[model samples]
Target: MKYISGIIAILLLSVFAACEDETKTCDSTLLSDLGMNFKKDTLQGFLVKDTIWPKVTLYAIGNDSVLINRQPRSSAFMPLDPLHDTCRFYLQLDSIAIPDTLTFRYKRVPSFVSPGCGFATFFSLDTVITTYNTIDSIHINNREVNSSNDTHISLYFIY
Candidate 1:
């Protein structure tokens, strides 16, 4: 009976150790999503840095899943594909009939974290392509995107 209790205690300790290790891995490695800030621009070069959209819908090209669905927001975060060097998105603002397309080109740097933890992806912004249907211009704030959720790009809408 003592031997059985000892074995059970060892198994419980092993389980607790595994849970602690998983927690550490999760804390270290996180999904790095690209952050975007919105702004309003006038023809006279007046810039409103923190412009809020009444409603915004966002999704990726070639994917039916919508990332954001008609939400009022001034900033958003979009995930980039670690397997691909480029990602394309379609965004509709304030019930606009025509949606603007944003293409992001980046260099993906994958870091092998551990055997149990797969990898963490970091991105360096290369270029951004946008359809000017509703968007006026784009500004790259930070070229590097990683675990920190900082604004990497800013979108300027013509007022």
Candidate 2:
């Protein structure tokens, strides 16, 4: 009966182990990315090369306040509307240089990445418009935007 008791204890231990929670904390890649470059001429659906601008000023569209005074880099992840279908961004250097306004109309869908991460919104670009100030042009490189470490739009600055 000792062998039978050992087997029972092993089975009970296995059962407890199975009942333990196995889900991991959620962290999702769900942001839409944008890249900037200086374009000498306008091109439809243009892609950015290694031509990164020295400094591109960024602002918040809600309060019209400066977010990054001088973003000395490229590829910034844009915020998406989780409940709405529109998002906007403002870029103004100063009075010397004209400002640019970007408007994005997209389709938002709830993305449930994990239990820990919960739900986040994913966007599919329907249309993108820009105010041609110092910017030469803007184009949507990828319509299906997700958090995939990829660029969705390319902003071409007048060189």
Indicate which candidate wins on lDDT: 1
**lDDT per residue (tens digit) for residues 1-159 in model 1:** 769999999999999987775534544546688999888876546546678898899998978899999999899889997889999998988796478999999999987555556678989999999999888888999988887788999998876
TM-scores of all predicted structures = 0.76, 0.68
Which pairs of residues collide in model 1? Answer: none
- Mark the regions of model 1 whose C-alpha exceeds 4 Å error after superposition: 1-25, 112-118
Judging by TM-score against the true structure, name the best candidate. 1
lDDT of 1 at 90: 88
Error of 1 at 111 (Å): 2.3
Candidate 2 has what TM-score? 0.68
Model 2 per-residue lDDT tens digits across residues 1-159: 769999999999999888756455445654544443344443444644545445667754775556567665554656665657887888764445777888889898677756666666667889888888777667677887666656677666645
lDDT scores of the candidates, listed in order: 0.85, 0.66
Q: For model 2, which pairs clash?
A: 29-147
Candidate 1 accuracy as TM-score: 0.76
Q: Lowest summed-lDDT stretch of 10 residues in model 1?
A: 21-30
